[model samples]
Target: MLQRPPAEPGMREDEVDTPALILDLDAFEVNLDAMAARLAPTGAKLRAHAKTHKSPVIAGLQRRRGAVGQCVQKVGEAEILAWGGVDDILVSNEVVSPLKLRRLAALNALARVQVCCDAPEAVPLLEEAAAAAGHRLGVLVEIDVGAGRCGVAPGPEAVALAERIAASPHLRFGGLQAYHGGAQHRRRPEERRAAIGGAAEAVRRTLEQLRQRGLDCPIVGGAGTGTFELELETGLWTEIQAGSYVFMDADYGRNEEAPGFRQSLFVLSQVMSAPRGTGRAVLDAGHKALPTDSGLPLVWGRPGLRYVGATDEHGALAVEDAAVPALGEKMRLVPGHCDPTVDRYDWYVGVRGGRVECLWPVAARGAMA
Candidate 1:
């Protein structure tokens, strides 16, 4: 169980506890709206990925903002979201183990659940689990769209797998999962566009083959904050599974055509040391508080200050300006990757009008099955 911080009464953003996972409510709502608006024009349904935020609180908010449902990477994540009142969820990855598949099958009693499969072998396991639970499972066939990870080849091979899934009495063919993870962070606009174009082509060909084989994909899904527009324009993907729009990160900022949104998520770190004339300041947040896979976290509002390094519990910031942040002064640091960074925290300190309004727990945090 997780302990939630009390709601801040008449909360001012500055009054929130330091080292908390702070969320700018205004920015967050704008992000949710922007994502909805963008997808609205394209007619692409949004099934925002829960693996990024990990909080069912955030998931519910997205659903309220026009997202059709939520997609989680693991069954544990799916279970948490379902319990949190998110009735529709898609496990956008493969479930290989019998134990995990059994758990997924059991979820059908309470929610609309879907899972993905990359090979024919997974179909039988899923079928057995669904039969044991006396439920039918929704299964999507993931095709490799140049990410070169966790997908079967496009065309005949993909068709064969889908046919096998459709043939299963306990399994229903959901659709195709063609996500180009590598295209999400291409810094150059042309590069990102080209990457998704290739992925879309692969998806189109696979869909054509599936059609020939009398397999109609119902919910072709996969996209991220980086290149969702390209996928939308292709008309190949029916559902867009983007999770980072609610809390944009530094890495997403690096994208050439970054989805329009402010970075609502941040690590509220307190300055622990400030050495005069050393042009350096140290904060309490490091690897433990934020993820650095996409690179170092950016110092929010401090243009002259750069986050130079991070240890387990400390982040080094180089200050080029004369004014120094005093000890105990709080600084907001934008993480490089929002998903993994969110996994590190236990609570989201909702800030409104400069004070903490509510504390939303990271309910599905560390749900790595």
Candidate 2:
């Protein structure tokens, strides 16, 4: 069930309910504009990953700022965006399920959709779905560009898969999905640069093979917030798939010289307890509200207040030089990982200048397939 609006327009940020997903509107807009300006020169459109914000409202904001399209990891997310009027989308991941491919292929009536394929066997299944729908499906060959998660090995192996995809009358060779997800949070700038450098070289070789095979690779897609600049430098990528730039999660902020994005997404929590003599305070928001896979959320703007641990319903703060937070005191927490933390909420309490400006649903929350 959907909860009531955490705070109405004109209400103070502190007036919002505890554990609310509050967006710092000013900071959020700045991050969006900064990304638009940063990528405007490179000619690579921001295929902003919807797995992060998961809101078509946010997608519309990005579209208004010049994003070419959105990228999703699942069919459910794609359906939410397409229903919400996102015309162009890429799965950016493989969809090997027969039923899921049919559902994805069905969206062709409403939007321009594409999916990534890394194996030859997946091609025939995609072909069946497209033939059933009587529409051509755009398929991107996902090359394993350092991220060993999901992708075909770059070079002849990837080229061979592309051949299989291009041979299918129902499928169109879209491009490559070369995102280095693990490199995004690498602490050092040099480490990130080196990681993307290797990925780019791999992409370069795959493109060469595609050229030799006489395949028309319309789009070469990939690049996250950490190494988007590096991808742009190579001039090999045609689409930049950055999603976290909209919400600077704590993990990304820890990067040395993190891509000049502000901390815009925060979980508004309140101090539920603080013993008079104790050196610790407990926040109402914990594991359920914030994902700690990346690390603990940071208490925003609180110098000595550290969020040390989290349980199901409470967050433990180790107070030091900072004063113990009083009961009912509201605070903002910079999430350790923005994407999953976003999945915990039903709505975003948009706040600016200490007042609530608007409320937007987390429309695609839990859109996992």
Candidate 3:
């Protein structure tokens, strides 16, 4: 088990409480710039997913970097970002509840709001809500681009959904939401490319069918950090929805090399207990502090150390040598998954040049409705 770090008088980086959520500002901005540069010539605008950072400050930075808009997973997230002054937002997931749909519809009174629909049953509810709110909502038909999650079948079904959305007085059929979320972590570059290729083909067929029906799709949005290049090259995706590029995590680092960006987000943890043991040490960050669904955290700057295990509030590290640091030492931990790990914290402890720079709030952290 790991012990908590001792409190100090002032806010030194080392003296800050253990298991704090840390954002490496320099690295983060570099990642941001790299993504913007890559998308500059492609003509594919970025709809950076706010589900990853959930920070208005980060969203503003992305907006400044040429991102056309931000994509979020829920109405609460849309509300937060819209209130935070984001001009464009897409509720990338489907909104079903009447109350949630009302909230989503209400956003149109302020900013551009797009939402997804994967089922026929959802359309009437959304139409009713939009009509009730007296707002025009942009609707995207979510296609199951191999994620097997929340999307309708890719071809004719998608066309039919689009037709329904287009016919609605209060809603406009925007385009298709064809995202292969599982492909982002497929490890092999070729595998990811192939997965996206199939997804692109599915989108292509869907678009053809829609056009055959005299329907035009203004947007076909999809792609994530790990396999965005493939989607960008496909010419099918008009917009790429990548959020993790701003804060790459351990799992993304495990992706095939030659990636356009680098890891930037980390959890700053303290060595609270330096108990004597070979190949075993403990840290103050655990499951609650750092998500491990993708895998355990990788100890940044420590080549031989491994964050092998964890509990609710403790992380055990497997030290490869006897020269491990003593108690009160601070270390940076690369999170396994940036999105969920970020959702766990309210504040992002921005650090630069080994010093605390600023604290940015996770404005939409728990916007899961």
Candidate 4:
């Protein structure tokens, strides 16, 4: 069930409800414009991943600033974006279930839908679903460019998969899905560069083989916020699937030379407990409100405050300063993982100049199917 808007328009930031998802509108718009300016020099286009923001409002904002489309990890996310009036969407991951494939095919009537596949056996099932739905769905061959997760080997094996996709009458051979998700968080710049270099080499070799078979790739999609600049320099990745650049997290901020973007998302938690002798402050947000997958959330702009631990509904903060956060005082927490943290809330309270400016729904929050 959706919750009521935590803050109404024109309300002060401190007046908003606790454990609310907050968006710094000024910083967010700056990030958006910064991303567009950064990508304008490179020939590559932005296909901002919806798996991070999960809001069609953000999608439209990105598209209006020059994003070609949006990318999602599931068919349900694709459906949500399509229904929300996003005309172009790609399920950057594989879908093997017949019901999911049918749903993806049916979405082609509403928007341009695409999905990735790694095995030849998956082609026939996708084709059958598309044929039944009377729509030609787009398919991309996912190459294992050092991610070692969900892609086929890059050379001849990828070419074989592309060949199979092209042979299917109901499917269109879109391009390659060569995302190196693991490399996106390598703390060192040299490590990230090496990882993306190897990935680009594999993709280059695979593209050569596809060319030998008279196949042309329209899109070579891959790259996340941490490694997008490196991938852009390679000139191999045509479409950047970066999402976190819009709302950075503590994990991405840990990179040696972090992506050029400010932190725009935060969990506005209020101090519910202030134990003077123990030097501890308890917040209303914890594991349930903010995800700790990447690391503990950071106390934004609070130098002496440290988020030490968390429970289901409470987060314990260690106070190193003499001035402890009083009860009813709001604190901004930069989440460790922005993606899952965004999934916990249904509405985003857009704040500008310390006042609520608007509210946007997290339309695809739990669209994990």
Candidate 5:
């Protein structure tokens, strides 16, 4: 069930309810502008992934800043974006289910929809769906590119899959989905450089084979906020599929070289319990609110106070240099992982200049297939 707005326009940030998803409007817009400026000099265009924000409203903002399209991880997310008036969407991940493929293919009338396929066997299922829908769907060949997740090997295997997609009467070759997800979080700059360098070589080999086969791969899409600079330097990927640039998290901050975007998204929690002499306080956000899979949430803007642990419904804060937070004191928390943490909330309380400005729904919140 969707929750009511935790805050309204003109309300002070402190007056907003606890455990709400907060967006610092200024920082968010700055991040958007920064990404646009960063990519303007490069050949790549932004295909901001909807799997991050899950809001078509945010997608629209990205489009206004000159994003080419949006990419999603699930068919439901594509439906949400298409129905919400986003005209272009790519399911960067593969969809093998005939049922899901049919639904995605049917959206072609409303938008330019695409999906990835690493296996040749999945081509027939996709063809059937596109044939039934009477719409030609775009299919990208997903090469492993060092992620070791969902993709075929780069050279002949990848070209073979692309050929399979091209030969299908109902499917057109889109390009390559070569995202190195694991490389994005690598701590050191050299580590990231080396990882993306290998990925670029793999993509180069695959592209060469595609050209030799007379296949025209129009789009090469992949890059996250962490390693987008490296991908941009290559001039290989035509579409940059970065999502987290708009909402920086603690995990991204830990990278040695730093992701250039500002921290904008936060879980607005309050000190619910603070007993005298305890040297700690409990917050209203925890496992159910700020996920710790990427590491514990950071205490934003509060010096010497650390978010050390969490339970089901509570976050333990070690209070040291900073005075104990009074009960009902609202604070912003930078979640460890922005993507999953976003799914935990139904609405984003947009704040600017310490006051509420707008409330946008987490429209595609649980779009898991």
Candidate 6:
């Protein structure tokens, strides 16, 4: 069930209900423009990962700014984006279930949809579903470019999978999915460079192998916000899937030389308790409202304040100064991880100049199939 919206237009920011998902519209627009401008010179297009924003409203905004389309992780998310009028989308992960493949194939009537496959056996299952739907499904061979996750090994292994996808009567072999997910959070610039360097080499060798097999690889899609520049330098990755650049989190911000993006997403929590002289305060938002996987949320713009810990319903704030936040004082928290933190919200309370401007539904939130 959808909960009541936390705030309405014309309301002051402080008037919003506690524990709301807040978006700084000014910063968000800047981030959007900055990302487009940065990628424009590289000749690579943006296929902004919708797995982070999960909203077609944001996707539309991104498209207006030159994004080719959106990238998602699940069939359900693709369904949401397609139903919401996003014409092009890529399920940038492997899908195996027969029922899910059928659903994916059915979406061809509404949008141009693509999915990744790492195994040759999965190709026929996908072929059968696409044939039943009477459409050719676009398939990318995901190469394990150091992120030992759901991708086939580079070179011969990846070429073999691509050959299977190309031979399928109902599948169109789209290029490689060589995203280095683990490298996106490497704290040092050199570390990220090395990681992406290895990934690029693997992609290079795989492309060569695909060519030698008489196969044409059209798109080399990969790269997140952290290492997009490096991938761009390699002149290999054609589609940049940098999602968190629009709403940077504490985890991304921790990088020594992080990408030039502002912190646009926040969890708005109100102070519910402040024991006298305890140097601590309690916030209404906690584990249930914010993600802690990357680490605790940062107290936005509060230099001396720290989010020490969180329970299910409360967050412990460590007050560095003697001035503890008064009761009902509103605080904005920059989430540790933007992706999962975004999944916890139902609506994005877009604020501009400290006033509520708009509310956009998290259309694909929890769309985990």
Whole-model lDDT values for every prediction:
0.88, 0.92, 0.87, 0.94, 0.94, 0.93
Residues 5-69 of candidate 1 have per-residue lDDT tens digits of 63465666666666778899999999998888888877689999999999889988888878889
- What tens digits encode model 2's per-residue C-alpha lDDT throughout 62-81? 99999999999999999999
- lDDT score of residue 169 within candidate 2: 97
Candidate 1 clashes between residue pairs 3 or more apart in a chain or in different chains? 11-355, 12-354, 12-355, 13-354, 13-355
**Using Cα atoms with residue i matched to residue i, what is each candidate's TM-score against the true structure?**
0.97, 0.98, 0.95, 0.99, 0.99, 0.99
Model 5 TM-score? 0.99
What candidate 4 gets wrong by more than 4 Å, as runs, is: none
Give candidate 1's error at residue 218 in angstroms. Answer: 0.4
**Better candidate number, 2 or 6, judged by lDDT:** 6
Query: Which sections of candidate 2 miss by over 4 Å?
Result: none
In candidate 5, where is summed lDDT lowest over 10 consecutive residues?
Answer: 1-10
Residues 285-321 of candidate 4: C-alpha lDDT, one tens digit per residue = 9999988889999999888998999899999999886
State residue 142's C-alpha deviation in candidate 4, in Å: 0.5
- Tens digits of per-residue lDDT for model 3, 108-225: 8678999999999898998999899887788999999999998999998999999999999998999999999999999888999889999989999999999999998999999998
Q: What is the per-residue lDDT of model 5 for residues 193-277, given as tens digits with 9 covering 90 to 100?
A: 9999999999999999999999998999999999999999999999999999999899999999899889999999999998889
lDDT of 5: 0.94
lDDT for each residue of candidate 6 in 237-348, tens digit (9 for 90 to 100): 8999999999999999999899989999999999999998788999999989987889999998878899999899999999986478899999899999999989988999
Tell me the spans in candidate 1 whose CA falls farther than 4 Å from its real position: 1-7
